[model samples]
Target: MKIKIYFRIIGLSVLFVLQSCEDFVDIDSPNFQMVTEDVYNKEKTTIAAIQGIYNQLYVANFSTYGVSVLGAMSADILLARTDTYLPFDQHELFSINTTDAGFNQNIWSSAYNMIYMVNRALEGLENANISDDLRQNLQGQILFTRAFTYFYLTNLYGDVPLLLTSDYDTNAIAPRNSKEEVWLQIESDLDEAAALLNKQTEYKDGERFYVNLSVVEAFRARVYLYRKDWSNAESFSSNVIARADLYGLEANPEDVFRANSKEAIWQITPDGVRNFAPEEATHFTLHVNGTGTTITGNTALSDDFLNSLVPLDKRRLWIGEVSSENEHSYFSKKYWFDNDGEIQQYSTVLRLAEQYLIRAEARAMQNKLAEAISDLDQIRARAGIDLITDSNPGINKQALLDTIMIARKRELFAEWGHRWFDLKRTGKVNTVFSSNPTWQNSDALYPIPGEERLKNPFLTQNDGYGN
Candidate 1:
């Protein structure tokens, strides 16, 4: 029932972070005194502290950076060229010594740092002189933020220290919790967040960058599906899918990642970013590095993944290829060059298509084949691929599950580590990587960062990862 809270205050300036109808307070602006107690005394300052977390998310190591380059390489979805992060690409990340693990350490450290900020804000809000309405909004937003983050932490690193307070002495030496323990906290935080906000909570200038009731439901649906709470998953996902005015599948599958797209349920904005293309686009793109001839970059779509798609799949339009001296490879055109010379592309974290996929899988698991196919076919139809209703209308439950799995891989590849998490959660990881002699079942969880273990002697490493 108890959770530890890690502590750190990221030096933040909310000046350029949010560009909405109402301006967020800029911490660095001369007008505000940023003392710890005073930061939450005013409504504007409290919201600024919350939005600062959102701004820093752009700098976090986690996220669907150009579809989560780190996790994609760990899965079969992406490949890195020679002389890159080979350990991640080869499933041998565990071989790295626990001491020199910034490669993996950054991910763990970054997330907990963000969690500490959320905890600090939540504490400040408890006695903040702000109005009830504003206080509730900030509280709900950060609690959801914390739960959203913990979902990834527990998924990537099996059991993690559950931190809930901003006290440094306790968190610095805290022990780990079971994965089930982490999920309970994640759900508990989400349930609390859901109670504080509602449908009429307007999006900032009608943008999806900020979380709302629908965003909370979409994520809760994901958590339920992962837990195999089939009926709850079906019901929650159905709620979001039915919000036709706020969400819909883009008829042209390629338009889904564009900023302000109807399909985007929640996104990280590129506002005030200096010359930024989305992280995924920047990493996944391959172009001539020296000569105007050869394509170069550490990351690209893997042939194993690319070849799995049915020929003529419209989603292929998201890919671009370049060949040099008989070496040809593909890159994602999913997020491409911005026209009109403004950075408007947003990093998509959750989308409507994923909601349908979640619903389809959830419904199928419960033997609701007809309803499941109806959901699956929506993705396939928009994909310009063969629809389940058209070709496999009477498919058996097992076959329908198989088709839905393929649909998820094809649709959600390289986005937020979906393919990686899906393979692990569905128990298909070892089979997928059986050819690699270096792989083991233990590779499913990332090693606890050595730096963190050094700081907290109580932190233990994951299986197959030595201290």
Candidate 2:
């Protein structure tokens, strides 16, 4: 299918206004070179370019700062430990505001930048006469990256413009597509990618950080679950589980987040990419290590959140540290750099433990209560909990689903920006999230960054933003 590339901002608006007449001459310049003929000509170079895309995933300001740090920590489940100057404590960092003291352009720019790279790679591959095998590998990588990004964008901002192509000179002024349409595109891309991706290729560091067929299947399953397609969700998730030889839960819950661990289906390895050591303070909301005056200082793991951890569960002690003073409850131990403050070794994205949670939820939805419990037990078993065979006798299916949700929260706590999405997707946003009064309105679905809206007139704010 021919997807039209849109680059409306190329010649329009004030950005173009300041350019000289020479700039206009270069606007339609064909001499700029094609990425296909120029970049992807060599197999090694093409693979390196793909690796560069993965490198971009490690940028702290974009992935770590916006999504993992802010989006993950600012949930009601977590509280600010210090009250000094954390922008997220007030819940204004990523929100839409007429004034400009704090605006989160990270989500907007990061996703688009990543999308731009993927688009370039994809366009380059399509034009290049690469071999079918290598072409499929590169194609799968780009498709998975695109789908993963759009999924995050769709969840954060309900309705988003689906810009499929990167050709700026032709299509422009693309209006916002409904969440359903975006999701459909995402599903199509992932399905295609899953088929094309290789399960045998190991990542540079020999971890599952790189996208593979299994990871794409896992992603497809999660995406289906998000759209409430239980059958497809179960199918994809079950497929991944059936390949238990390839991926499964870690032996210990703590090992899942430790520096190096097997059983990782997909993750973003923080290798020579981006170091969070010096700038780790800015990446997190508050100083989990209590050094930064940002969100970490203002907030911490809530006592209720901490207390919720079962006694035998080692994850509670593994994932957090007690506050120096008696003021804050629990500071996150997940992202701490352990090379005596020299190196940061952690995966920003995780899959194994989360996949189990996903399977459990799907099984519960299908009323396979025993199977659901079995999935839950896989996670619990590592955490030192007995198998949940006879735990629920009188509770209904919905109640069992609720139990699954709680288990998900406990199992995947603070790994990625999951809690908020889990709460929102389950239609429990208004119900469970109501305890904190600020998190009201559909605007909770992330605000389109002001800069994006300012640049493109087609993008509309979610309802209740202006009025």
Candidate 3:
């Protein structure tokens, strides 16, 4: 299913289902409620419910579908290419102004919408007559989804109102919790999800998009990494990496994300036919006319970083191009699908490469430099580059750490919103991002969307936006 158009459907459904009771009464049927109930009744419905969650990934609305993409856009890997035309830059959040209605509103709405559906699904499963095993699995999925949604919300908005229960009425006006409180809830939800989900099973097709025990663990590791709980982060990441045969470093760093290739530990993409191209157009300048005629300007990769890649590194080939035509700068080539002829493209959410990198970083932080080097070597070897074989091998801790982080930058360039978050986690936000260069610290987190803040007066605006 080309989930590209799903936001419109979801938006309409929300309007029809969430507007005044008169609209609900006017409807020929209870849309959200009936679908919620019907989906819970059957295994197929539950399966579809999971698919519906993946649908959120491919949709275009930042609030309902496009938040991750938007987050990445504001980061370093990708550029908006089109000025004022793209909502991200036009509203100036990328540059830290934070008054953009389109940018903030989309993020707020998207997080809440996913939360709403996930809560509804959890409630549906609770009321369902499914077997305990089946119910547990469904619950696992719901728990992970809720945690995943809140992870995005809290990370972006800091202290957001925690909505653990599905009681829409009472939870509507709840006050914002502290960032620490929100992370606690996130940790709890992932723990429950990991316990319930079967880590042994491998889901095929769209089923892979849904959260599993491993996914929850990986995310928890990510959360811990964000919170700087390096030990727990290392532990969770190690557990996932122990299943290395199932989820190891991609054999070819290039093949790891060849649009349709399958080394993905987790990914959410639209059906190619009607969806976006291999990657979003915002990251790359497209030569659509086939004569190198520029169709759109892309967010160029940093020249200093691009030059740091070793000559033999395969990822450099995959990401950087030698274009002499349009101003001659390094542009991202990760999603260069010429045939698609449109903007929206398949976006990658998670990959095994990140797991390896995470494992390496976590281990190094734990002072396991040799072990960290092994992990880092796996990535470098796949990129056809030589391993770090220097005689001065006594763990130059900070240098090794820097190398691993730099490798992350090279490996995951434009894949997701890594640069900004990576910078934030490493305390490089101010150093890397000078005052309002592209976007600033006040722009650090997007403003609480105007509509959401209005609806819930308890919602506090993120810093730097109030002025």
Give me the displacement of residue 146 in model 2, in angstroms. 0.2
How much lDDT does each candidate structure score? 0.77, 0.63, 0.64
Error of 3 at 425 (Å): 1.5
User: Better model by TM-score, 1 or 3?
Assistant: 1
Measured with C-alpha atoms, the lDDT of residue 17 in candidate 3 is 24
Among these predictions, the greatest lDDT belongs to 1
Rank candidates, lDDT, best first: 1, 3, 2
Q: Ranking by TM-score, best first?
A: 1, 2, 3
Model 1 scores what on Cα lDDT?
0.77
lDDT of 2 by residue, 1-467 (tens): 11111121221221111121112123442222343455566666666666666666665234655565556555555654444324444444443443321335645655666675677678767756568888998799889989988887887778877877655442235578898899999999997897787564445456666777777887888988898888888888887777756666677654665443566667664345333452233333343345532223434666777778888786765555543343334556655555555543456365667777888888788888788888887877787866677565556788778778888877665655688788778777677656655655553676676565665677777764551
Report the Cα lDDT for residue 57, model 3: 49
Question: In terms of TM-score, how similar is model 1 to the real structure?
Answer: 0.91
Q: What is the lDDT of residue 338 in candidate 3?
A: 48
Q: Which residue window of length 10 is worst by lDDT in model 2?
A: 1-10
